[model samples]
Target: MSNMNVIVEKLLAIDGALAAAIVDSNSGMILGSGGSGVDLELAAAGNTEVVRAKTKTMKSLGLKDNIEDILITLGKQYHILRPIDKQDGLFIYAVLDKSKANLALARRKVLDAEQALVM
Candidate 1:
Protein backbone atom coordinates (compact mmCIF):
# COMPACT_ATOMS: atom_id res chain seq x y z
CA MET A 1 0.00 0.00 0.00
CA SER A 2 1.04 3.55 -0.62
CA ASN A 3 1.49 6.19 2.02
CA MET A 4 0.07 9.72 1.85
CA ASN A 5 3.23 11.20 0.40
CA VAL A 6 3.49 8.55 -2.24
CA ILE A 7 -0.10 9.03 -3.26
CA VAL A 8 0.31 12.76 -3.60
CA GLU A 9 3.49 12.35 -5.64
CA LYS A 10 1.91 9.83 -7.96
CA LEU A 11 -1.05 12.08 -8.53
CA LEU A 12 1.21 14.95 -9.45
CA ALA A 13 2.89 12.77 -12.01
CA ILE A 14 -0.28 12.63 -14.02
CA ASP A 15 -0.13 14.86 -17.05
CA GLY A 16 -1.57 18.35 -16.47
CA ALA A 17 -2.06 17.77 -12.75
CA LEU A 18 -1.76 21.04 -10.92
CA ALA A 19 -2.45 20.12 -7.32
CA ALA A 20 -3.40 17.15 -5.19
CA ALA A 21 -4.40 16.78 -1.56
CA ILE A 22 -5.80 14.35 0.95
CA VAL A 23 -8.51 16.03 2.95
CA ASP A 24 -10.60 15.28 6.00
CA SER A 25 -14.23 15.73 5.06
CA ASN A 26 -15.41 15.95 8.64
CA SER A 27 -13.05 18.70 9.75
CA GLY A 28 -12.22 20.34 6.41
CA MET A 29 -8.54 19.82 7.11
CA ILE A 30 -5.86 18.84 4.66
CA LEU A 31 -3.95 15.73 5.65
CA GLY A 32 -1.32 15.77 2.92
CA SER A 33 -0.84 17.90 -0.22
CA GLY A 34 1.52 18.46 -3.13
CA GLY A 35 1.99 20.27 -6.45
CA SER A 36 1.11 23.95 -7.17
CA GLY A 37 -1.09 26.46 -9.05
CA VAL A 38 -4.15 26.36 -6.82
CA ASP A 39 -4.39 27.00 -3.11
CA LEU A 40 -4.96 23.57 -1.65
CA GLU A 41 -5.91 24.74 1.84
CA LEU A 42 -8.83 26.73 0.54
CA ALA A 43 -9.80 24.02 -1.93
CA ALA A 44 -9.78 21.42 0.82
CA ALA A 45 -12.05 23.43 3.08
CA GLY A 46 -14.44 24.43 0.33
CA ASN A 47 -14.61 20.94 -1.14
CA THR A 48 -15.45 19.55 2.28
CA GLU A 49 -18.64 21.51 2.14
CA VAL A 50 -19.29 20.24 -1.37
CA VAL A 51 -18.95 16.64 -0.18
CA ARG A 52 -21.12 17.24 2.86
CA ALA A 53 -23.81 18.92 0.84
CA LYS A 54 -23.90 16.16 -1.75
CA THR A 55 -24.05 13.49 0.92
CA LYS A 56 -26.87 15.28 2.68
CA THR A 57 -28.76 15.62 -0.56
CA MET A 58 -28.26 11.95 -1.36
CA LYS A 59 -29.64 10.96 2.01
CA SER A 60 -32.60 13.26 1.61
CA LEU A 61 -33.32 11.67 -1.73
CA GLY A 62 -33.15 8.16 -0.17
CA LEU A 63 -30.39 7.07 -2.46
CA LYS A 64 -28.71 3.92 -1.21
CA ASP A 65 -25.45 4.54 -2.96
CA ASN A 66 -22.06 5.93 -2.22
CA ILE A 67 -20.37 8.65 -4.27
CA GLU A 68 -17.71 7.43 -6.63
CA ASP A 69 -16.34 10.89 -7.19
CA ILE A 70 -17.34 14.50 -7.68
CA LEU A 71 -16.18 16.29 -10.77
CA ILE A 72 -16.14 20.05 -11.10
CA THR A 73 -15.29 21.28 -14.54
CA LEU A 74 -14.23 24.84 -15.02
CA GLY A 75 -13.23 26.84 -18.06
CA LYS A 76 -9.56 26.16 -17.48
CA GLN A 77 -9.44 23.39 -14.93
CA TYR A 78 -10.95 20.15 -13.77
CA HIS A 79 -11.33 19.33 -10.11
CA ILE A 80 -11.89 15.78 -8.94
CA LEU A 81 -12.89 14.80 -5.42
CA ARG A 82 -12.95 11.10 -4.68
CA PRO A 83 -13.94 9.67 -1.33
CA ILE A 84 -11.67 7.01 0.10
CA ASP A 85 -13.31 3.60 0.24
CA LYS A 86 -11.43 2.31 3.27
CA GLN A 87 -11.49 5.54 5.25
CA ASP A 88 -14.60 7.48 5.96
CA GLY A 89 -14.20 11.25 6.36
CA LEU A 90 -11.22 11.24 4.05
CA PHE A 91 -10.91 11.99 0.33
CA ILE A 92 -8.51 12.56 -2.53
CA TYR A 93 -8.66 15.92 -4.30
CA ALA A 94 -6.94 16.57 -7.58
CA VAL A 95 -6.86 19.56 -9.92
CA LEU A 96 -5.91 19.25 -13.56
CA ASP A 97 -5.60 21.60 -16.47
CA LYS A 98 -8.62 21.20 -18.68
CA SER A 99 -6.81 21.61 -21.94
CA LYS A 100 -4.00 19.22 -21.14
CA ALA A 101 -5.55 16.55 -18.96
CA ASN A 102 -7.48 13.54 -20.08
CA LEU A 103 -10.53 13.26 -17.81
CA ALA A 104 -11.06 9.53 -18.29
CA LEU A 105 -7.47 8.64 -17.59
CA ALA A 106 -7.28 10.99 -14.65
CA ARG A 107 -10.32 9.43 -13.06
CA ARG A 108 -8.93 5.94 -13.53
CA LYS A 109 -5.58 6.97 -12.09
CA VAL A 110 -7.24 8.51 -9.07
CA LEU A 111 -9.24 5.35 -8.51
CA ASP A 112 -6.12 3.24 -8.72
CA ALA A 113 -4.31 5.52 -6.33
CA GLU A 114 -7.22 5.46 -3.92
CA GLN A 115 -7.15 1.68 -3.77
CA ALA A 116 -3.47 1.64 -3.01
CA LEU A 117 -3.63 4.43 -0.47
CA VAL A 118 -2.96 3.42 3.13
CA MET A 119 -4.31 5.77 5.71
Candidate 2:
Protein backbone atom coordinates (compact mmCIF):
# COMPACT_ATOMS: atom_id res chain seq x y z
CA MET A 1 0.00 0.00 0.00
CA SER A 2 1.04 3.60 -0.56
CA ASN A 3 1.15 6.57 1.78
CA MET A 4 -1.67 9.14 1.85
CA ASN A 5 0.13 11.77 -0.24
CA VAL A 6 0.91 9.31 -2.98
CA ILE A 7 -2.69 8.22 -3.09
CA VAL A 8 -3.91 11.79 -3.15
CA GLU A 9 -1.48 12.59 -5.93
CA LYS A 10 -2.70 9.71 -8.03
CA LEU A 11 -6.27 10.87 -7.53
CA LEU A 12 -5.47 14.42 -8.52
CA ALA A 13 -3.80 13.22 -11.70
CA ILE A 14 -7.09 11.86 -12.96
CA ASP A 15 -8.87 13.72 -15.71
CA GLY A 16 -10.79 16.78 -14.53
CA ALA A 17 -9.91 16.23 -10.87
CA LEU A 18 -10.96 19.22 -8.81
CA ALA A 19 -10.04 17.96 -5.34
CA ALA A 20 -9.19 14.86 -3.38
CA ALA A 21 -8.86 13.97 0.28
CA ILE A 22 -8.24 11.13 2.67
CA VAL A 23 -10.89 11.59 5.33
CA ASP A 24 -11.31 10.15 8.78
CA SER A 25 -14.91 9.10 8.92
CA ASN A 26 -15.01 8.90 12.71
CA SER A 27 -14.25 12.60 13.07
CA GLY A 28 -15.07 13.99 9.62
CA MET A 29 -11.60 15.47 9.31
CA ILE A 30 -9.24 15.54 6.36
CA LEU A 31 -5.96 13.72 6.94
CA GLY A 32 -4.40 14.42 3.53
CA SER A 33 -5.68 16.43 0.60
CA GLY A 34 -4.76 18.08 -2.72
CA GLY A 35 -6.08 20.16 -5.62
CA SER A 36 -8.49 23.12 -5.39
CA GLY A 37 -11.53 24.90 -6.85
CA VAL A 38 -13.66 23.18 -4.20
CA ASP A 39 -14.07 23.59 -0.48
CA LEU A 40 -12.58 20.23 0.48
CA GLU A 41 -12.75 20.91 4.22
CA LEU A 42 -16.50 21.34 4.18
CA ALA A 43 -16.85 18.48 1.74
CA ALA A 44 -14.91 16.11 3.99
CA ALA A 45 -17.17 16.78 6.96
CA GLY A 46 -20.38 16.54 4.96
CA ASN A 47 -19.34 13.38 3.14
CA THR A 48 -18.64 11.67 6.45
CA GLU A 49 -22.32 11.75 7.18
CA VAL A 50 -23.04 10.37 3.76
CA VAL A 51 -20.85 7.34 4.40
CA ARG A 52 -22.35 6.78 7.83
CA ALA A 53 -25.92 7.03 6.62
CA LYS A 54 -25.31 4.61 3.79
CA THR A 55 -23.68 2.13 6.10
CA LYS A 56 -26.58 2.41 8.49
CA THR A 57 -29.10 1.84 5.72
CA MET A 58 -27.15 -1.11 4.39
CA LYS A 59 -27.11 -2.80 7.78
CA SER A 60 -30.78 -2.13 8.21
CA LEU A 61 -31.39 -4.00 4.96
CA GLY A 62 -29.18 -6.87 6.23
CA LEU A 63 -26.87 -6.79 3.24
CA LYS A 64 -23.72 -8.78 3.98
CA ASP A 65 -21.60 -6.90 1.47
CA ASN A 66 -19.44 -3.82 1.71
CA ILE A 67 -19.73 -0.65 -0.36
CA GLU A 68 -17.25 -0.44 -3.18
CA ASP A 69 -17.83 3.30 -3.39
CA ILE A 70 -20.53 5.96 -3.35
CA LEU A 71 -21.04 7.95 -6.55
CA ILE A 72 -22.94 11.22 -6.27
CA THR A 73 -23.63 12.66 -9.71
CA LEU A 74 -24.34 16.34 -9.88
CA GLY A 75 -25.33 18.58 -12.75
CA LYS A 76 -21.79 19.93 -12.89
CA GLN A 77 -19.59 17.43 -11.10
CA TYR A 78 -19.01 13.92 -9.82
CA HIS A 79 -18.38 13.16 -6.18
CA ILE A 80 -16.76 9.85 -5.35
CA LEU A 81 -16.60 8.41 -1.85
CA ARG A 82 -14.61 5.22 -1.65
CA PRO A 83 -14.06 3.45 1.65
CA ILE A 84 -10.49 2.30 2.02
CA ASP A 85 -10.57 -1.44 2.48
CA LYS A 86 -7.20 -1.65 4.21
CA GLN A 87 -8.18 0.88 6.83
CA ASP A 88 -11.26 0.93 8.98
CA GLY A 89 -13.14 4.19 9.58
CA LEU A 90 -11.47 5.97 6.68
CA PHE A 91 -12.33 6.80 3.09
CA ILE A 92 -11.16 8.65 -0.03
CA TYR A 93 -13.21 11.52 -1.43
CA ALA A 94 -12.73 12.95 -4.90
CA VAL A 95 -14.45 15.62 -6.96
CA LEU A 96 -14.23 15.78 -10.74
CA ASP A 97 -15.61 18.00 -13.46
CA LYS A 98 -18.39 16.05 -15.09
CA SER A 99 -18.03 17.53 -18.54
CA LYS A 100 -14.38 16.71 -18.93
CA ALA A 101 -14.17 13.58 -16.79
CA ASN A 102 -14.65 10.05 -17.98
CA LEU A 103 -16.90 8.67 -15.27
CA ALA A 104 -15.85 5.07 -15.85
CA LEU A 105 -12.17 5.91 -15.80
CA ALA A 106 -12.53 8.27 -12.85
CA ARG A 107 -14.31 5.62 -10.82
CA ARG A 108 -11.60 3.14 -11.72
CA LYS A 109 -8.92 5.59 -10.62
CA VAL A 110 -10.65 6.17 -7.31
CA LEU A 111 -10.84 2.43 -6.75
CA ASP A 112 -7.16 2.21 -7.58
CA ALA A 113 -6.41 4.89 -5.04
CA GLU A 114 -8.57 3.14 -2.44
CA GLN A 115 -6.69 -0.10 -2.90
CA ALA A 116 -3.36 1.69 -2.75
CA LEU A 117 -4.05 3.84 0.33
CA VAL A 118 -2.15 3.14 3.54
CA MET A 119 -3.56 4.74 6.66
Candidate 3:
Protein backbone atom coordinates (compact mmCIF):
# COMPACT_ATOMS: atom_id res chain seq x y z
CA MET A 1 0.00 0.00 0.00
CA SER A 2 1.07 3.58 -0.66
CA ASN A 3 0.58 6.75 1.34
CA MET A 4 -2.28 9.22 0.89
CA ASN A 5 -0.12 11.39 -1.34
CA VAL A 6 0.50 8.52 -3.70
CA ILE A 7 -3.19 7.79 -3.84
CA VAL A 8 -4.00 11.41 -4.66
CA GLU A 9 -1.33 11.49 -7.34
CA LYS A 10 -2.67 8.33 -8.92
CA LEU A 11 -6.20 9.72 -8.89
CA LEU A 12 -5.14 12.89 -10.71
CA ALA A 13 -3.81 10.82 -13.57
CA ILE A 14 -7.29 9.55 -14.33
CA ASP A 15 -8.71 10.81 -17.62
CA GLY A 16 -10.65 14.08 -17.29
CA ALA A 17 -9.97 14.24 -13.56
CA LEU A 18 -10.42 17.73 -12.21
CA ALA A 19 -9.82 17.43 -8.46
CA ALA A 20 -9.23 14.86 -5.76
CA ALA A 21 -9.10 14.91 -1.99
CA ILE A 22 -9.03 12.65 1.05
CA VAL A 23 -11.44 14.10 3.56
CA ASP A 24 -12.14 13.49 7.25
CA SER A 25 -15.84 12.84 7.48
CA ASN A 26 -15.83 13.25 11.22
CA SER A 27 -14.48 16.78 11.13
CA GLY A 28 -14.85 17.80 7.52
CA MET A 29 -11.12 18.37 7.18
CA ILE A 30 -9.15 17.59 4.04
CA LEU A 31 -6.13 15.40 4.73
CA GLY A 32 -4.71 15.57 1.16
CA SER A 33 -5.69 17.15 -2.11
CA GLY A 34 -4.55 17.50 -5.73
CA GLY A 35 -5.54 18.61 -9.23
CA SER A 36 -7.34 21.83 -10.27
CA GLY A 37 -10.49 23.55 -11.64
CA VAL A 38 -12.25 23.01 -8.30
CA ASP A 39 -11.98 24.25 -4.72
CA LEU A 40 -11.11 21.17 -2.79
CA GLU A 41 -11.59 22.78 0.61
CA LEU A 42 -15.18 23.65 -0.15
CA ALA A 43 -15.85 20.29 -1.63
CA ALA A 44 -14.40 18.48 1.35
CA ALA A 45 -16.61 20.38 3.76
CA GLY A 46 -19.79 20.04 1.72
CA ASN A 47 -19.34 16.42 0.89
CA THR A 48 -18.71 15.52 4.53
CA GLU A 49 -22.29 16.51 5.22
CA VAL A 50 -23.40 14.31 2.37
CA VAL A 51 -21.72 11.29 3.88
CA ARG A 52 -23.10 12.01 7.33
CA ALA A 53 -26.62 12.46 6.05
CA LYS A 54 -26.66 9.24 4.14
CA THR A 55 -25.27 7.28 7.04
CA LYS A 56 -27.77 8.80 9.39
CA THR A 57 -30.66 8.10 7.06
CA MET A 58 -29.61 4.50 6.71
CA LYS A 59 -29.49 4.07 10.47
CA SER A 60 -32.93 5.62 10.85
CA LEU A 61 -34.31 3.19 8.30
CA GLY A 62 -32.74 0.23 10.15
CA LEU A 63 -30.48 -0.74 7.31
CA LYS A 64 -27.24 -2.52 8.16
CA ASP A 65 -24.80 -1.68 5.41
CA ASN A 66 -21.96 0.41 4.18
CA ILE A 67 -21.79 3.21 1.62
CA GLU A 68 -19.89 1.92 -1.36
CA ASP A 69 -19.81 5.39 -2.90
CA ILE A 70 -21.89 8.40 -3.72
CA LEU A 71 -21.99 9.63 -7.30
CA ILE A 72 -23.33 13.08 -8.05
CA THR A 73 -23.83 13.87 -11.72
CA LEU A 74 -23.95 17.49 -12.73
CA GLY A 75 -24.65 19.03 -16.07
CA LYS A 76 -20.95 19.01 -16.91
CA GLN A 77 -19.25 17.09 -14.14
CA TYR A 78 -19.21 13.92 -12.06
CA HIS A 79 -18.41 13.79 -8.35
CA ILE A 80 -17.55 10.54 -6.62
CA LEU A 81 -17.34 10.16 -2.84
CA ARG A 82 -16.09 6.79 -1.71
CA PRO A 83 -15.58 5.88 1.93
CA ILE A 84 -12.36 4.08 2.61
CA ASP A 85 -12.71 0.58 3.95
CA LYS A 86 -10.95 -0.21 7.26
CA GLN A 87 -10.53 3.53 7.74
CA ASP A 88 -13.60 4.84 9.39
CA GLY A 89 -14.63 8.46 8.78
CA LEU A 90 -12.34 9.03 5.82
CA PHE A 91 -13.43 9.21 2.22
CA ILE A 92 -11.96 9.78 -1.25
CA TYR A 93 -13.48 12.54 -3.32
CA ALA A 94 -12.92 12.87 -7.04
CA VAL A 95 -14.29 15.16 -9.74
CA LEU A 96 -14.32 14.55 -13.47
CA ASP A 97 -15.46 16.32 -16.58
CA LYS A 98 -18.68 14.71 -17.73
CA SER A 99 -18.02 15.07 -21.43
CA LYS A 100 -14.46 13.80 -21.30
CA ALA A 101 -14.75 11.13 -18.64
CA ASN A 102 -15.92 7.56 -18.80
CA LEU A 103 -18.12 7.36 -15.70
CA ALA A 104 -17.77 3.65 -15.06
CA LEU A 105 -14.04 3.69 -15.57
CA ALA A 106 -13.62 6.76 -13.45
CA ARG A 107 -15.64 5.24 -10.63
CA ARG A 108 -13.52 2.12 -10.77
CA LYS A 109 -10.37 4.21 -10.71
CA VAL A 110 -11.58 6.02 -7.63
CA LEU A 111 -12.34 2.71 -5.94
CA ASP A 112 -8.90 1.40 -6.84
CA ALA A 113 -7.23 4.50 -5.51
CA GLU A 114 -9.15 4.29 -2.27
CA GLN A 115 -8.17 0.68 -1.82
CA ALA A 116 -4.52 1.50 -2.35
CA LEU A 117 -4.56 4.40 0.09
CA VAL A 118 -2.48 4.14 3.26
CA MET A 119 -2.45 6.46 6.24
Clashes of each: 0, 0, 0
Off by over 4 Å in 3: none
Write one digit per residue (lDDT tens) for candidate 2, span 1-119: 44989989999999999999999999999999999988999999999999999999999999999999999999999999999887989999999999999999999999988887665
Q: In order, what lDDT does every prediction score?
A: 0.95, 0.93, 0.92
User: lDDT of candidate 1 vs native?
Assistant: 0.95
Q: Supply the TM-score for candidate 1.
A: 0.97
The model with the greater TM-score, 1 or 3, is 1
Over 1-119, each residue of candidate 3 has an lDDT whose tens digit, in order, gives: 54989899989998999999999999999999999998899889999999999999999999999999999999999999999987999999999999989999998999899878776
For all predictions, the C-alpha RMSD in Å is 1.1, 1.3, 1.2
lDDT for model 3: 0.92
State every prediction's TM-score relative to the real structure.
0.97, 0.96, 0.96
Residue 55, model 3: lDDT of 95
Candidate 2: residue pairs that collide: none
TM-score ranking from best candidate downward = 1, 3, 2
TM accuracy, model 3: 0.96
Query: Candidate 2 — which residues are off by over 4 angstroms?
Result: none
